[model samples]
Each structure stands twice: as C-alpha cells, then as structure tokens.
Target: MISQNTINTVFETARVEEVIGDFVNLKRAGSNFKGLSPFSDERSPSFMVSPAKGIWKDFSTGKGGNSVKFLMEHSQFTYPEAIRYLARKYNIEIEETEQTDAEKAITDVRESMYLVSEFAKDYFHRTLINSEEGKAIGLSYFKERGFTNETIKKFDLGYSPETWDALTKEALGKGYKLEFLESTGLTIPREDRPFDRFKGRVMFPIQSMSGRVLGFGGRILTNDKKAAKYLNSPESDIYHKSKVLYGIYQAKQSIAKQNNCYLVEGYTDVIQFNQAGIENVVASSGTALTPDQIRLINRLTRNITVLFDGDAAGLRASIRGIDLILEEGMNVRVCGFPDGEDPDSFARKNSHDELVAYLEENSKDFIQFKASLLMKDAKNDPIKKADLIRDMVTSISKIPDRIQREVYTQECARIMDISEQVLVSTLAQLIQKDLTEANKKQKQEQKPFEVLRNQNPKNTGYSGGDPDDPRTGPPDGYMEEPGYPQQQQAEKVDILYRLERKVIEILLLYGDKTEEFEDVFLKSNDEGEVVMVSEKKQYKVHQRIYLSLQEDEVELSNNLFRDIFTDIIGFYHQNEKFSLEQYLMRLEPDFAQEVTDILMEDERLALHDWEGQNIFTKGKHETIAQYVSETVMSMRWFLVGKIIEELKSSIQPENSDNTELLSMVMDYSKLVNSFSKKLGRVMSRYH
Candidate 1:
C-alpha cells in the first residue's frame, strides 16, 4: 500500500491537464480545455477538462473523474497501478509495506499476465545482450538489419534461445507460474512439458498506450520453410491484435503533435519509419485494418497518411481500409513506394530528410491516388472505366461530412473525366440504398421487442391481478387528471431526479462557503392573523442545506446522491476546511466520479465561446446562497408531491371510510401550496 502522505502529495502536485494531455489533444476552450473523446469515436470535441477542479468529463461517453481516475478509465489500470503511474510521473517516492506470498497469489489473472509478459520482455532482452546464442543469432540479425544498440534497447528488442524450454525453465525457476506464462501465450502448455512459444526468434515487445508490455511479436532469422517466418502472440486478455496498433505507445504523442499519423503494414515498417525520424507511424501488423485500430489513431489525429508497398494487389486490398477511415470522418492520403521496395527497405535506404521529403512530395489524396492507380488498369475499356468510377464514388460516399462528400465527389468527377451530373445521381442512389438497408436492419433487430410489447398486459389494457384490491386499483397508466398523459408523470420523475442532482451539485460547489440566508416561517401576527415572517441569518451553505433537509425529514431518494450528501456533510463537520483534491482522493472512485460529473456538468457551457458572443454568464459563487436555498426548496416541493402521490395511492375507493387518507392528502396539498407560494412558482406539472 502507498502511504497516505505520498498519495496526498501526488494528488496536490500532479496537474490533470498535464497528465491527460499526454494522451489527448486538448486545446484551449475558454477557462477549460476541450478535446475529442478518447473513449468514443467523435469528430467534434466533447471532452472537457477543468484545471481548477483537477477533473475531466467526456460528454460523449459520460465518463468523468479526477486525474487518477482518467488513467484508470483510459488505460484500464487498477487503482493501485494508477497511483503508481502518477507517482512515477510526478517523481513521488511511494512508501509501502512489502506484500506476503499469499497476498501476491491473490493478484488477478489479467495483472498476472501483464507481470509475466514484462518478465519475458526483460528476460529476452537480457539474453540478447548477455548470452552467446542470442548474440550470435538474434543480436546479429538485428544489427544486420541496421538497428543500433540504443534503438534495440529503446524498443526492448530481445531474443529467445533455440532450445524450446529455455524461457519456460528460466521463468519457472524464478517462481513465476506456468499458468500466467501460458495465459500470455509465452508458453505453450502440454501434459508432459511446456515450452517457450517464441524460441529461436528475435522478439519485439508490444506495449499498451501507457507503455506496459502486453504481448510480443517475434521474427525467425533462419530459413525454415515449414516454420512461419513471423509470429505474434495470440489474442490474450491484455492484447487484441485488431485493436492493438504497433508503435502506438511511442507514436501517440507525436501523432497528436503532428496532427497526422503514418499507417504502415508491419512492425519493421513502424520501427524503420521511427528510425528515419518519423515518430508518428503505426502499423496494423499485417492484419486487415479494423475500426478499433483506426479509432485509436483517431483519438490523437484527424489525418492519416497510409504508406504502402508497390505491389498492385496489396495496394488494392488496402484501399478498402481507406473507406473505413473516411467513414470515421477523417482525412486520408496514400503514398506508395517504388516497385520492389517496402516501407522498411525504403526508409533504410534513405536519409531521414530524404525519406520525409519523399513522403510529403509523393502523398496524394485518397481519391486522386485511387483514380490514378486504377486508371492504368482501365485504359480504353469503357466497362472497366465505369466500374472504376463507381468504385471511387463508393469510397467518397463513406465520408460522414456532407460538404466533404460533395467536395470529394467533384474531385472524383474531374479525375475520371465524368459529368458531375452522372456522379451526383450515382452518389445519391448509393446513399439512399445504404439508408434503406440500415432501416431494414434496425426493424429486423427490433422485431422481437415489438412482439414483446404487443404481448404486454398493460398494452392489452388488462391490468394484472387482484383488480378488486384497492391496493392494486387502476393501472398507473390510467391518470386521474384529464388531458395529462402518463408521459408527463415520467417527466415529473425526471424533474425530481434533476432537482436531486442539483442539490448535489450545489453542495459540491459551495459546501464550505458561508452566506446569508432568509429563514421563512408562518407565524401568528398581532391580530391573530397568520402571516409569513423572515429572519436574516448566516450559515455555511452545506450547514443550511443539511439543517433544512433534516427539519423537513427529507431523505435523498437516489442511493448515490444520499451517500454523497451524507459524506459531504460529515466531511464539512469534521474538518475546518475543505480541499477538492483531498475530498476526491478520499472517496471511492465511483463516488468521486459522480461528484466530478455533477460539479463539471455546467462547464460545457464555457466551451461555446459564450463570452465571445457577449452573452455573459453568472459564476456560481456569486449566487451560492440563492442557488442553495432554491435547490433545497425545489427538493422539498418535489418530495411533498411524492407524499401526495403515495397518499392518493393508499385511498381505498371500494371502502367507505377513506376519510383519513383523503384528509391527509388535503394537508399535504396545503403544504405543497404554501411551498409553491413561497417559491413564487406554480406546480404546473402536478396539475
């Protein structure tokens, strides 16, 4: 366990923007920063970070939390791991008690696999530099491939010995379990014995975005026709090939800085490009490009330049991936190397500046590249030329932005020497066909749910069981008031939920601020006439809310809100001062996240450049007292209405003596009316 002092120090010292900026491309949005959500695929920016509060929220996915929580959500780090990462980043020394073997055994499977993979990465690297076989075979192969020792060490390149069981035995003797090794695809298990999966191969350790080793790729140096030349770790808990891009861990920052990524085809391609001073390159590792991989790059950039080898067939197959990228609302360009040369070979042969110049000078928009590449194959054949034109139109249609689609369509028309009218008609037909198919698919998916709705008792107007029992009187769908649908009742519930959330928001924002408040009550005046009287009193915002709610016997209906309310009140009572960072660090992650969401919900308004439009907004602190009093009063009114609802539900129409329940309803109604008058608002929803 990390000491409380170290955790507190980290919380105070580590800036949220500084930590998250490493992964997200955040730009200034007024007082806050805004960026595209890393958790979802979004073209427009919806993720906001509040540096004042040390929190971030993604409106796209509704995930929000402090700096530590962001790491946990984005990188799948456990709480302790997140803390350690922050500790390392901030250079805070972690004070800890050593864990026992029993405690170590309780570590989860995914974490165990991570540990095993890291161990293998270290073991292989050690062998490559220190062992005779590794130096002669693996190290020599890497050196021949023009990899310097620093480059080898930087990427954690390594070697596995020729003996199948060498790594397995070494790991086992070091007290690492076979279960984790096999789970990570490092060891292949058998009844008689287990052996290393990458024996006799040079290793390339694949890392997560946060730089944890998740798996490895290995290359065979010798000519063994029966054995595959390149092998990757099979899909494991921590590594899914389609979702994992080679060099993403290294390239994410560069991709964000350059605002473009270089998509390549293999691990060596990524490494060579990086060596050639292009750090924004990632590879699909030869698998077909997947949306998840594209999304990973999309988080950092909106532009991708796919580098391809000269093979005509490979180029054609890769064009399909360009359509996927276009569908994601990203700009894409393509650059193909000279015949008989791949990215790795071309990058190796050129100086850094030369390689970069070749890419910049040769790269073309997807439409231009597609048209020029296919026009040769369609020479003078009218049928082939029409097919090629339609293919280009199909790729163009995948762009989500309408303006972009129109622009690309014009470009396609010019490239194909076709009439703009003909292309537009074909594009319209393709779009309509896609829309129709999508609607058809949606209806098919909802067919079973539609049957379920038809079969429902409420839909059939048959209210279930014991109809004579007043407890089960009319169905909830049958309303007492005329012209008010059941949906309004749902809307009322939403209103209450919003009010409850508002109370939480107020407490979180101003719990410690002292303010003047009006204490109102009904009292008998001099002539024995009842009149409203108010007294000026000063109280902390949280104390006022706590006392008011307690006096009315109102309890928060939502479990999360109630828990948070109790904790905040107790924290205020116990401490002389409140620290937002300390309070966040003290709560469990989920509770802290809920608090952050509530506190930062209105921060999105700042992103609209409202001040630039001369539409000024009031800061919360300026009206804390009014805000707190109104929220509490609204909550009281909502709760009173709920009480009226319960009383009405309890009245037995079948029985004659329902006087007490009806009188109780009238009393609550009077209270509601008084609250409505005091609030200077009518309960229109109730009517």
Candidate 2:
C-alpha cells in the first residue's frame, strides 16, 4: 500500500499540465490548455487541461481526470505504477509496504520489460560513446550523416555491437532477465542461447510520446542485399508501431505551441529537422501512416505538412496515404525536396534559415500539390484531364469536415477550370455512399441490441442518462411544468436517471460540506393522527441526500447511478471526514471519469465569465441548502408521478383492485401536490 502522506505529496506536488505534458502536447487556450484528444482521432482542439483545477478533460472522448488518472488511462499503469511515475516526476519519495511475491511478479513483468528496454537504451548509448568498435562504426556512421554530438545524445541514438551475444551477455551478466529481453525483442532466443537482434546496427530508440523507450528501430550498415536495411522491435505490450509516432515525445510541446506539425518519413528526417531548428516534426518511422498515428499528431495540432522525398512515383504512391490525414479532418500541405534530396540530405545541406525558408515557401495545399505533380502527365489530354479531376474530387471527398471539403472543392474547380457544380455533385455522391455504408455497418453492429429493444419496448425509451447531466432531469425531452404530460416508465426512468444523477452530483461535489437544512419530522397530534412539522437542522450535503432517499425508500433506476449512490452512502459511513479529490481516486475508472466530467464541465461558462453575456447560470454555492432540498423534492415529486403513470397504465376501472389502485393513485397525487407547494414549483403536467 502507498502511504497516504506520499500520495498526498504526489498529488499536491504534481501539476496536471506538467504530468500530461510529458505524454501530450498542450497549448494555451485562454486559462486552460487545449490539444487534440490523445484518446481519439480528432482535428479540432477538444482535449483540455485545467491547471487551476488540477484536472484535464477530453471533450472529444468524454474522459477527464487529474494527473494520476491521466497516467493510468494513457499508460495503462497500475495504481502503484502511476503513483511511482508521479513520485519520480515530482521528486516525491514514495513510502510503501513491500508487496507479496505474487503481487511483485504480477506487477514487475511489465515493469521489468520497461526496465530492460531502458537498460538496453543506456547500454547502447554507452557502447556508442565508450566502446572502440561503436565509435569506429556507429558514431562514425552518425557523424558522416551530419549528425552532431548534441543531436546524437538528444535522440538517445546508439549502437548495438556486431558480436552475436554482446548485449545478451551484458544484460544477463547485469542480472536483467532473458525473458524480458526476448519479450522486448531486444534479444533472439535459441534452444541453447540467445543473441542480440540489432547486432551491427546503429539504433534509434522508439519512444512513446512521453519518451519512455517502448522499443527500438535499428538500421544496418551492411550492404548485404539479403538483409533488410532497417529492423524494428516486434510488437510488444509496450509498443504499437502503427500507433506510435517517432519524435512525438520531443516535438509535442512545440507542435502544440505552434499549432502545426511536420510529418516526415525517417528517424533521421525527424532529427535533421529538429537540428535545423524546426522543433515541431515527427516521423512515421518509415511505416505506412495509420489513423492512430495521425490522431497522435492531431493531439498537438490540426495542421500537418508531409515532407516527400523527390521520388515522384513514390510521392504519387504516398498521396493515397496522405488522404488518411485528410480523412481525419486535418489541414494537410505537401512539400517535396528537389530530386536526390530527402529531409535528411536537404537539412544537412542547408543552414537553419535556408531549410526553414525552403519548407515555408514550397509547402502547397494538398490540391495544389496533387495538381502540380500529376498535371504533367495530364497535359491537355481531355480524357486524362477528366480522370485527374475525378481523382482530386475523390481526395477532397475524404475530408470529414463539410466546410473544408466545400472549400477544397472550390479551389480544385478553379485550378482545373471546371464547374463547382460538377465537383460538388461528385462529392455528394461519395458522402452519400459513405453514409449508406456507415448506416449498414451500424445496423449490423446493433443487430443484437435491436432484438433486445424489440423484446423490451421500455428499453427503447429507457436510454440511460447522458454523461454530462447526472443531476436533476435530462433537459431534453423532459421539462417540469412545461405543458408536458405524465411520464411513462421509460421517461420516468430517464427522469429518475437525471434526478438521481443530480442528487449524486450534489453528494459528490458538496457531500461533506456542512450546511443548515430543514428536517421534516412527523408527530402524533392529540387527535391520534400524524402531522408533519419542519424544524431547522444542520447536516452535510451527503447526510441530507442519503436521509431523504432512505426516508422515501427511493432507489435510482439506473444501475450506474444506484451503484454510485450506495457507494457514497457507504463511504460516508466509513469516514465522516471526506475529501472529494481523495474519494474520486478510489472509485473505478468509469465512475471516476463520470464524476470528473460533471465537476469540471463548466469551464466555458466559468472561464469566460458567461454571466457577463447575461447567461442564466445557477448560483451553485450561494443556495447550496435550498438547491439540495429542491433537487431532492424535484426527484421525489417525479417519482410520485412515475408511480401514478404506471398505475394509470396498468389499472382497469372495473377490476377488483380498482378502488384500491385509485386510492393509491390519489395518495401519490396528494404527495406530489404537497411537495410542489414546498418546492414552490407548479406541476403543469399534472393538470
């Protein structure tokens, strides 16, 4: 177990932006920092970091949390690993009891793999600098490529020796496990022994965006046509080659700051650009670009400039992949070097100013690049020209943003001397085809759910609460005293979902805050009838909500809301003193994310002071007691109506239990009426 003091130190000392910054690129957006969501593919800035609240929210994925949560979600780190990461990052000394051997094995396997990778990186670096062979080969190779010592160390570039077992022997002798070596694909295992995989190759340590050495990319110096020139570590738990963007760890901040990213092909290309003073660049590590890789870059910026080497055939081949970036809704521009030069050669040949100038002046919008490159072949051949125009239209069709697609189509039409109507008609056909396919796919995926919904009609109307509204009732489709009729079971459940959510939101946000409350008590009058009386009482928010729910025998209709409510009540029982921050940390990830979303969602309103624009914002703190009571009353009133609706739907006028049912209905109606008076709200739906 981690000591509470250490956890507190880690939480207090770690700034959310600083911790997430290690993994994501973040840029200032007013009081907060906005980036593309690391969790999903998106172009716009929807991932937000609030340093003031010490929390971050991805509006795109609807996931939000503090520093520790970010580590857990992003790295899949266990609680201890997350704690240790924060402790190391913030320089807090962790004090924890030793775990059992079973626990150690379960946790240490992944950690051990990481440890082995880090050790290998260090060993390779030391080998490149200290060993005579490494200097003669690896260091010399880098120097000849025009990499300075600073660039070499900055990227943690290294050399694996040519000897078959040099790294294996070193790792085993140093007590590192061969299992981890094999798992990280650093060493190849045989029946009798293991040998290094990157032997005789100068190494590039592939890092996660946060700079953890997930794996390696090694380039062989041998001219043997038989051997693959570049070898990469096999996919392990730590690395997903398609998802990982090389140099993201180094370039994220600069990319986010500049709101642009330069995409290149090789590790050397990324390094050369950085060395030439363009800090916002990453390489796809010579792999075909994937949505995941584009999303990774999208997290930092919406604009991507892909640098193509002078091979027009290869460039034409890469143009298809460039559409992947467009499909992600990013602004893509293409820049190509002169024949015989790639970014590495180009950067090495030019000064910083020249390199930067060349890129800025040459980078053209995707349409322009495509037209310029492909136009030479089209050369006034009407048939070929039409094909080229259709090709441009297809590229434009991949863009998800309607506005951007329209704008690109206009530019294409002007350049091609074609009508906008023709391009737009083609684009519409593509989009409609996509929609038809998407709906077909969705139906296939939802076939089982559709069957279930058919079997259970209520479930169709019984959609659970929206993630954002946990409190009160869903604003959509349900409004109190707004000329709506009595809610059926499904709508009632939704209302209940909202109310229960609202009730829980209050409990979580102000659960332990002490406040004055009106407690109602029933007393027996002299006539032997119970009468209600109200008296001033003092209780915390959680106490008030829990007691009200207990008194009414009310349970939330939604499973998630019920579970959270029960947990809250149990938590309050175990500890009278509550800390919201500490409490959220202990909930399951799904629940914690939900709570964090509700808590930090008002940034737009709060940060912009929307009240200045005459927005009708609720006074959260000013009317805490009244708000709690009103919200509770609102829920109780809705429950009475829900039961009434159920009774009205189920009961028959001539049934044997008809009178009894009618009496029960009247009783619920009376209850609803009395609460309405107390709440000072009219139940127009009742009439």
lDDT of 2 by residue, 1-687 (tens): 788889888877888988887667677776787666778765556677888767888876778898888887787776777888888877788898767888656746777888899999999999999999999999999999888999999999999999999999999999998899999999998998789999999999998876678999999998989889999999998878999989988898899788899998899999988988998999989888998888887766789998989986659646967889888888899999999989889998899999889988999999999899889999989999999998999899899878889899999999999999999999999889989999999999999988996885543442446534324324432433323333543353345666777887788778888899887655789999977778998987888888887776777776777888889888988996876666776789778877777666665334344555666678777989999998888887776677788888878757456887888888788777678768777975533
For candidate 1, give the lDDT of residue 421. 92
| RMSD of every prediction | 6.1, 5.6
RMSD of 1: 6.1
**lDDT score, residue 126, model 2?**
96
TM-score of 2: 0.83
Task: List model 1 lDDT by residue over 114-223, tens digit each.
Answer: 88899999999999999999999999998888888878887999999999899999999998999999999999999999989999999999998898898999999889
- When summed lDDT is taken over every stretch of 10 residues in candidate 2, the lowest stretch is 476-485
